[model samples]
Structures are given as C-alpha cells and as structure tokens.
Target: MSSTQQPQPVLNCDDLLELIPAYAFGLASPKEQQQVESGLTTCPEATAQLADYRRMQDDLRESVPQIEPPPALEDRLMAAIAAEPPARRRMPQVHRAWWAAAAAVVALVFSNVYWISRSSSAPPKAPDTNSHPILVQGDSSFVLTSSREIRWVRLPSAQKNTDATAVLMWNVESEIGLLYVRGFPPLSAGKTFQLWLTMGDAKLSAGTFQVDETGSGALLFNVTAPIDEYTWARITEEPEQGSSEPGEAVVVVGEL
Candidate 1:
C-alpha cells in the first residue's frame, strides 16, 4: 500500500480522527463512527496535536545520530588490564622432578627394606592399647574434628572453654555421627550450634545443643539415609529458640 493511501476506513476522516487512539489501538467498531464524528466537531485541536506528534516522531527517526565508538575505548580498556606477573615462567618440563621422585622412591624402598630387616632381626615391641586404640599394634590414632581430619600427635590435656583433640574415626556404618564435644567454646545466651546432615532433598537436623562451663556436651546427629550413606556433615550457629532449618554459617563440616 502507498503511504498516501489511508487504510480504507469504514468511518469518514472527521469520524476516524476523533477515534484516532481507539482506531490506532484497533478498537473502533463501525457502529461507533457517529460518536467519533460528534467528538471531532468539538475537538479539532486534539487531531492537530496528534498529527504534529506523528510528524515530529518521523523526523526524529530519520535524524538520530549513529557515531563510531571512540578510539580511546581500546586504550582505556588496555590501561585497565593488569599485566599478569610473567606467568611464573613455567619451570622447564624436564623429567628432572620425576628423576628426583624416582630417587626418593628408591630411598624409601631401601629404607623400608632395611627397617623390615631390622624389625625381623629384633624382638617385637610391647603393646600399648590403652593410650593408643587401633586394630593393629603399630597403627596410630588421629583426631578428626567436625571441620576436618587432623593427625593427632601429642595433645595437651584439654582445659575448659578451649579446643580439645581426640582420635576420631568414622565407621562406614554411621555415615554421619555425633561428635560429643567437651572443653570447647560455650554458647552465648539464647543461641546454640545446630548440626545438619545434607544428603537428600531437605537438610536433616541433627540437634540444637550447647556446651557447659566444663564444655561437656553431646551433639546428637543421625547419619544420612541408607545407613552407610555418604553425606556432608555441618554445624551452624542458630537461635536459642532453635531453627526449623539451617540458618547460620557452617562452623564445622566434614565428609562421611
């Protein structure tokens, strides 16, 4: 259709102009043409205003500027870039480390053989199962906290309101179990540490508990479903009223 040809209107120009918004909005019916004609008789100024607006819009569409991006855009971007420290000049990929590693392995093998020979030559050492509880004689115990596992060597006797260490081993049976703590930080008024078993669709609450002045307390926790379920265990600080769900930072966590 030519631009000059107005869409074949059922209403006259005077009637159509009056119904411009509704007509422009495609809402004018053939029966409403009389009412539209009556409106134009009293509102010719509105028609002129709409015409002026349409002309201004057309002019703007043709005149809007489209300029190229500034050359400094590249310079500005480059200036913002921090030159990465000479990539640490990757150490030459030679088999030198492997050779060193091979040498260490040889030394370890020789040392192990020598120790085995010495042990076979010498008599067996006496057992100390009380202080060191392990299935085997030479096996050592390591303290594993709620956070992460740590190799326990010589730990000082635990004092009240202080961290304590102990040999903790998780049996595959209890995927997540309680770490009844003692000699640790006491809970502030109206707050407690909550344990969680994040295994399934929803987090399972172990229990909301606190420590006493002696720092003796039991944190009740259930392993995730399926008995030997692999789950991430965590402890979070919660309101004294207790939380229906987890609502604090994870104070401790460990995989079981």
Candidate 2:
C-alpha cells in the first residue's frame, strides 16, 4: 500500500523571534519549545537573537558590584537574630512515633522534673516514685534564675582550650538553658565557638557564641525538648558560618 505524507511547515523568523526569549528563560510550552527549536535551525536571525539574550543576562549579573548592608540595618538584623531561639535537634532516620514514646517514658521515670515548687500556679505533684531530678546544688552564679529541675554540670577543659572551664544550667520543664564559660582564648579569625547537646544518637546545635578578651562568656539557649533527657554536652570550635556536625576542636566537655 502506498500513502502520501504531508510535510511539516517551516516556522518563519518573525514568529520565532517572539518565542525565542520565552524558550531561553524556560517559560515556553512544549509545543512552543519545539517550534522555536526547529525555527532556530533554519533562521540565523532567531539564533543570533537567542545568543544575544543569553549574553545580555550574563552581563547583567556580572556587572552588579558587591554592596555591604548599612550599619543600622545590620544592627537590627543582629538584634532580631539574637531574640530568636536555636532550632530543635533532629533524630535522623528515626520515626516520629518513637520520639513521642521515648519522651513519654522519660516523663514517667522522672515525674518531678518539671515541678516548679515555688510557682503558685504549679500543678499538683505527681507521685515521684523514682529518684529526684538534679536540683540546685550550690550557690553558683551559673544558674541566673531559680527554677525547678535545673541541671548544673561543670565542664572542664577539653583537648583544645586547656585553661577553659564552663558550667551549664538547664530547666527541664521550661526548656531554658544557660552556659557560663571562662578562661578561653579568643578564637582565630573566621573561627566560632558553638555549644552542642548530645541527645540519644543525635547531636544538636544549641547556638554559637563569642567570648571576651579574658575568655569569659555566657549564653542563654532554649530548646523545645526537655534538656535533662540529654546526657552530654560539648563546646567546640567551628567555622564562622557554622557546621552541621562537630569538629575536632573540643574546648569544654561535660556530662549532664
């Protein structure tokens, strides 16, 4: 059997010129993309226009000079950043139900961990069958406020800063924590100090902070979870932009 096939029409340059910009910017539909591509092969004017558009985009991007933010805007941004809390730690590859169940079990074991003894609106105490949670041990300045279930742990110097010492005070219920560090030398240029919480199999960033010339600094960090559920803490030196994981520079280490 013999059948005659009709030839497809050639798209002219005038029509292809209008669609060229859309194809270059990825805004062309499938049909338009096919038409413009076929037209570019035969129309030298359309091809040159496409190349010119590409060059123009590149030139526009490269021509802009770097501009630093104004001092007042930078200050406001920094102030806003300081007011916001650090992100919560994540247990990668763990199921969400497992996290809830674990939290429940910890709450059952340490029932009195959230007892704000002095608060008038505090809830009636649950039968605290287990041993009492960590309380205010001594008259230390590390704990700025009087809160229940406060864990005060001494962090001694680690591998990096031998003279540095730190103390951590955290409230289990309120999710408020404080860190007091002393005797740390100023970090080198582009280096920053960060606090990390070791919770279960995950390590979470508490926040980054800076110390004075004498190596004394204090940071107030907040966590959405109960701080007492974690067992360990570490102060490490990280890049100025921050890190997803801890580095080898362990300045102060403690068990909470």
Candidate 3:
C-alpha cells in the first residue's frame, strides 16, 4: 500500500512578521531564520519590515549596556538551598493524595522559614531609583522596574480596543529602544504606519512600519537625545514612504 505524506504548514506574512523580532535579534532557530530570509525575498512588505527590525537590533546591541551578573549570585543561591533542613529534602512515598497535602505543607513551612531568615539578616541594598519606568497602555500598576542598566516597558492596548497590542523596551541611559506591535490592521497599498516621538510641541519621527494581514509589525530606533525628553509616542497613518510630520489619522497613542 502507498502512504501519502502530510504537507508541512506554510508560514504567511503575518507568521513571518511574528518571527522577525527573534530573527533580527539572532534568537530564532536556524530553520526559522531561513524561513524569514526566504519570505523576505518574496514579500516586499516583509522585506521592509525586516530591514527596520535589523536596524533596531543593531542599535539595541550598540546602545544597551551589558553587565555580567554577580559571580557569587549562583553560589549564594545554591548555598541557601543546601541550608534547608534535611527533613524537608526527604519526601515519604505516600499515596498521591497524601503526597499532595505533604507537598503543600512543606512548601508553606519552607517559604515562611526562608523569609524569616532573610528578614533577620542584614538589610539588602536598595535598587537604583533612576531607572526609567516602562508604562504599558495607561495602567500604572503594570510598570516594570529594573535594577540593571536597561528599563523595559510593555504598553497595553487602548481601552475597549482588542484589536492591537504593543511593547516598547529600551534603556533610556543607552539611548536605544525597540517597539514591537501585533494585531493592528493591515494598510492599503501606497499607505504605511509612522511612529512619532512627541516632545512638548515638537514631534520627531522614529521610523515607519507596516503590519502583516494579522496586524503585526516592529521598529527599532536610536534616541539621539535622552528618552526622558520625549513625553509621548504615537503611531499614525501616512503615505507609503512616510511623512515629515504626523498626519491627522491617529492609529494608537501612548504616554512615555
């Protein structure tokens, strides 16, 4: 009997866009990177989007400060785990239900003991307060605070709007940032989306982007000046090549 072979799944433009960020960052698997490269040759829109993402990746590498983790961090963590009581390390071979109950109790006791010890020890050093707060959407509760050199902000979708989502991660000190967007509507021919960094009355162009059928796109740009200087970021509809100034058509707006 002859057996039929199953066809492999084909990635569309939207699928390729989703992988663009990873590809540009060299985080994509070899197969995925090859697929993105192949897609770029066939899709002009994907090609343009890849170019922008590559530029962003380059800027991110140059601008973001890299610091090695404390050498003793892992050793300390391992020592702490080793210091836990030997009784806690030994688990009785009981029935499944009894095992679950015992596990829960052990977890509670261990956590309480660990916290108590930590509280009695020397006070930990304070984190850097000058880190840039990444505000997602308009919600202040979801802010990401980093003690490291870079500060990342994940922006949420507009109120009552389920159509799109965006994330902006950057190191204000390094003057480098990356914006990844998904679920925005695809533009018509001869039209594209433009990103603007608003500073008081002045609005500077970050770069332009185009989404796939599923509304996914990304942009990487270097902030020549301090990010604090820019108060707002917004995406607007513009001509294919983009415009010097933002047009009246606003797609999405976010506070920096």
Candidate 4:
C-alpha cells in the first residue's frame, strides 16, 4: 500500500469532533489547518477534543447572534434568480447538461448545510467551567474572525519571512465586541499587516491587512466605544505609507 502508504483517514472522536468548527472559526484550510495540526500533535484524545471545541467557542462568544439576510432573504434570492430559464439559444449540447444539473443541486444543498452546520457549537466545558461572553444587543460592536491556517517563514529578522496567525476574539456585551482570528500569515511582495489598539497611550488604528495563499484574512471593525477600553493588542509591519507608531515587531501579541 505504498502509494504514499495510503491508510490515513481514521481520525475519530468523530474526526476530532469534526475539526472543531475549522478549529474555532479560524476556518482551517492551510492544508486543513495542517491536517488539524497534525491531528492535534498525535491526538491526546484529539487534544482533549480540541479543548472541548475551544470551550464551546468561549461559551458561544457569550451568546453570539446578529444573523441577517431575511429581508425575505433578498426577496427570495431575487425570486429565484428571476425564475431561471435564461441561457437560451436552444440546447447547444443541452448546455453541459443544463449546467451540470445546476451544479449538482448546489453541491447537494451545500453538503447538507455543511453537515447540518457541523454540530452547532456547545460542547467544551469542564476545566472548572466558567464563562461570560455575552453582549449581543443591537449587534455591531466589533467582530472579525478569520483563520484558515497559513504560515511560511524565512526568519532572520524577516526582511520578508512570511506571516499568519490571526486572533481578535472579543465580545464585550451590549457594550459590544467580538473579533476572532486564527493562524493567519501570507503576504509576499510589498507586505502589509497593521492592526493595533491600546488604551494607555491611546494608540487606536484598527485596520490594514494582507493575506492570501489560503491564509484568509477578514475585517469588521465598528466601535463607537466599549471594547473594554482596549488594553493592548498588536500586529505591525507596515509602511505602505502607514504608521503613526509601532513601526515593526510584535507580529502577534495578546491582552485585550
């Protein structure tokens, strides 16, 4: 069986609980987040089942919700794309079986709604279980989560060493907040990565990004106040005419 010794897919505990929502919304795709980080570095029961799905995603981001798209879902997706039937010119080879049967019924209904929305959260808790991630009100404080794993370094004080490790999980309740990032790094040729929020010296400028090569990147910052008065968070390496301070260093830091 040496076609690269085929016989791997046995990662269960239900495939590390289905790779924990792409490992807590960091959205695994850097080769499936390095094959779920090499199956959680040799599965200590899948690393305690992905730390109970990252503590039930920090207690469901303390009750996260702000779902939209129900303005009759854009009038029922523009009334079903204006009632189909438009590729006329009468059956030119039945137009690739009518667009491959409408792309196999939209990939079998989006893979059955991604396997029923992959276990809909709620699982990990018990490490002295304590949580407090609420702040849903009128939704729109700050939320941005993105990580599909991507890191390719060349170090030596990086004049260009590649990067990716995203994190900005914040949920400050009605005062509003939620930013999430995971394993993000990928930017070559005229680099860029800047995001910072401090309170002491009041250095606020939460924006700037670059990542692709499957190390997905995202942004959604809207703060009119209350991100717990920001207490340090960083990401710098700018200079496409950007920088009021923090020239470079601290590729990833915490505390916010």
Candidate 5:
C-alpha cells in the first residue's frame, strides 16, 4: 500500500504581507483573518505591519476635530415640541408634585406596549437541532432528518474551471454534510488542502484531505454548531503540518 503524500507550502511571506491591511480592517474573510493572526505569531515583520496599521488608524482618528452640538440646541428642540399639537406635544402638567408620578405611569404603559409590539413583530428564531440524536446508515452515511431534505451548494473555484467542480450537500437541521471535489490538481510536496466553516466574523476548521491522481476528493464533516449559525465553507492549500489559520490561496468556496 502507498503512503499518503505530505502537503507543501503554497503561500509565502510576501503573499501574506499584502493581505495585512484587509485583515486589520476586518475586510478579510474569517479564513483570511485566521491566516493573518497565524502570520503575526510566527513573523515579526507581519506583526510590525499590523502595529503600523493600528497606529495609522489611531492617528487618523486623532486628526479629526471633535465637534460638540450647541448647548441651546436642546432648548430650541423643546420649544418646537411645545408648539406642536397636544397629540404630538409633551403631556400637560398636572399638579407640580404629581407630575413626576403621572409621567412614570405613562412611561410604564408605553414600555409595555412597545415590548408587546416588538415581541409580536419580530420573527421566531429557528429551532436548534444539534442536541437531537443522529441516524446512521449501513454505508456509514448518516442524516439528521428522516426525510433528509438536503441543500446543495456549488463551490466556485478560485481559478475559473469549466471542467473542475465541487459541491456540498447538508441538512440545515442535521448539520451533517459531505464535500465532493473533482478535477483539482493533486497537492505538491509539503502541501495539503484544509476545510473551514465560517460564521459571521469567526471561522472553524472542518478538517483536511488530499486529492487523488484523478483530481478527486471527498470529506464528511459533522458541524458541531447549529448549521444556521454558519455562513459558508472554504477550502485552502496549506503546508503538510497544516495551518491553525487559512492561507490566501483559496481553492474553493461554498455559501451555506
């Protein structure tokens, strides 16, 4: 039997250096954000670049003059409010001692109505199905639901490929998914492909694998978090030991 080949370095220091500004500004994807953080830990030069960007942001803020609104603005606003119809204006004054007490009651009523309307108007949250027991099949495939309404996500290649294709099928309720890739070049020495799940500003690793000589690969991952919480899945090339963070070399991306 043949041994598995190790992954090679696909991205170098210079490539990561170019991504620092985007990473610092929170414009980079979660995977890229992880890469920047990892680079900062290993490379002093990347760390200095990050510090420079931070200092520049601070300097930009300091350069702007802090302007305050005029003190009379509040009084003028109150005068306008007083001029409006009673329905739009502040409540009429009761006896001076009781005014505060009456105002508090009005505020309480408004607060209750506001809360009731908000509760009724807002959409209900999706149920969390992660706690439910999963079902496994004889083929080793499992699903979260008996009906198994699977969502198919087509992953776009970083390099345009008419022949290359990748897809992910997952049940939002089950959070169990499979990734299939075809017509991708096998990794070079010291390089491996890693998968990531992105949720808002955070990214979590799904796992890693290599393609066969035919340029085909597959991965089965059980999402630990609720599937609704994640936004996308991404694949990137990294070194044999694998990266704690993703590199700039994105191979494929699929929206969740």
Candidate 6:
C-alpha cells in the first residue's frame, strides 16, 4: 500500500457515511452532528467525501425539476393508508405479499412527512457562516484561526473527465483547505493525487490524497498564501512522494 493510502480509520466509517445525507441536509440531530464532527477527525478525506455526496445530491435535486402533484394526491394517499390496517400479531414467518404491503405503508408514511415539511413557503435558512473548521492530524488539532470567510468553488472543467465532479472549500485566513472529487479513472500504480495553489509565477503544494478503488479522493492541507493571492488551484497525479512542480497531468482545476 502507498503511504498516502486512505487514513487508517474514521470510527464506524460506513455508519458515518450513511448519516452524511442527513448531515448535509441539516436533518441530522445535534447528537448525530457531534458524532460526525468528532470522528471526522480520524479521516479528513472522509469529510471531503461527505462534501462530494452533498454536492452530488444538490445537483441531482436541481436537475430534477419540481413537479406539483395533483390536488387529490394528499387525500387519495391518506385513504389508501387508512384502508391498510396494521397486523396486530407478530407472524412466525413473513411472506412476499406481506413485504409488498409493508413497503407501501412505509412509502405512505414518508409521503405524509414530506408534504408536511414542504408546506412552509419560506426558503430554507443558510447555515451559520461565522465559523471555522477544526483540522486534526493524529492526536493534535487546531481550530482554524481564520477570518470569517469560506469559499465553496466548483471546479468548472476537467482535462480528463467527461463526467467528473470536484469542489474546493478553502479558508483564506487559515491558509487551509479541503477538496473532494469523484469520477476520475483510477491511476496506474505509483501515481498519487496532489493539490497545487498558484500565483502568477509561483506555485505551492497545498496537499495530497490517495484515491480509493472507487476513484474518489480528498485532501485537507495548508495553503501557503491567502486565497486571493492565488489565481487558481489544481489536483494532479504525480509520483507517490508528489512533486514541487506538477509532474503528471492535471486531473482537476479550479479558480481560487
């Protein structure tokens, strides 16, 4: 395995990922949020992966135009729910028919909840922006002493991807940033992912990450200069130790 292999652990990482959809949607409870934040330290790449999921979800939602249901959608759905009464006694064995009916019941329940929540006309409030990210490396950690500025920039184009997605979240004051990317083809052995922060004639290595089997990767790294000082950023596949100057092809790029 490469030294850059995904960091050892992020607690119950599978469980944490399952919670990401809720976490990103702001539907997670305070306790769940805390659980993610506390364990998110073990693998900052996982946190970046979570961000990728959030962006994908938002893009999916945006692409699917909203279609209002028929006026009777609510009333008809309610009647169908009432018609199917619950089975009072536990069965020794469940059958296929029973499973089908149970699925319908679950659907009805979620439909009701969705409609109720969407009843409000007000747009959702934004997450509080006056906060900083805590970056942890092993036992030591630091809350970014950053100015109250965070930038969420989507990498608009990729040299190697026809359907890849990447997003960069950078804190200018802290000189630290996290990047998450999905859909790039896995590289040949001996290659690794590296980030580049560029100012006119100067370039600095911001961070590096190892891609998993799924060809998704992320990194949290120290930026050498303020975001405004850099005109762009990039992710490149280089030798395992990475390069001071980009050696391999750049896979993803974005404006700072």
Q: CA lDDT of each candidate? A: 0.45, 0.66, 0.59, 0.48, 0.61, 0.59
Instruction: Please give the lDDT score for candidate 6.
Output: 0.59
- TM-score, one value per model: 0.32, 0.43, 0.41, 0.21, 0.44, 0.44
lDDT of 5 by residue, 34-60 (tens): 666556656778789989999999999
The lDDT, on a scale of 0 to 1, for candidate 1 is 0.45
The candidate, 1 or 6, that scores higher on lDDT is 6
Q: Can you write out model 2's per-residue Cα lDDT over 1-256, one digit (the tens) per residue? A: 2221222355888988999989988899777777776677789999998999899989989899979878799889889989995543333234334323323332333333332223324334332333232222122111223222344677888743158988776544456676667788789999989999998899899888777677776665666577777778999999987789999888988887
Candidate that would win on lDDT = 2
Best of the two (2, 3) by TM-score: 2
Clashes of each: 0, 0, 1, 16, 4, 0
- Model 4 misses residue 217 by how many Å? 0.9
Q: What ranking of all candidate models by lDDT puts the best one first?
A: 2, 5, 3, 6, 4, 1
Which tens-of-lDDT digit does each residue in 1-256 have in candidate 1?
Answer: 5443333325455555656666434477644543554454457664675577577768878897988899999887776665532221121335335323322332232222111111233323333332221111122211112222211111222222236421112323333332444344667788887766666666777667665576544432444453234355556668987788887455555544
Q: How much is 34 displaced in model 6, in angstroms?
A: 48
lDDT of 3 at 169: 51
Which lDDT tens digits does candidate 4 get at residues 1-256? 4443333454555676677677767886555555565566556876786787788878988897867656778888879889984431222343335323322332232322111111326422211123321112222322211111111111111222345354444433323332333345555567676677787877776766554456544333445565566676677767655577777555665565
Q: Model 4, 38: alpha-carbon shift in Å?
A: 49
> For model 3, how does the per-residue alpha-carbon lDDT over 1-256 read when each residue is reduced to its tens digit?
2222222244788888888878877899767776776676556777788789878778878997888989999999899889974331111233324323322332242322111121233323322344222222211111123334334444555423356666555543445555667667678889998888888899999878777666776655565676656778888889999999998877777877
Model 6: residues with Cα > 4 Å off, grouped in runs: 1-133, 138-148
Looking at model 3, report the run of 10 residues with the lowest lDDT sum.
Answer: 135-144
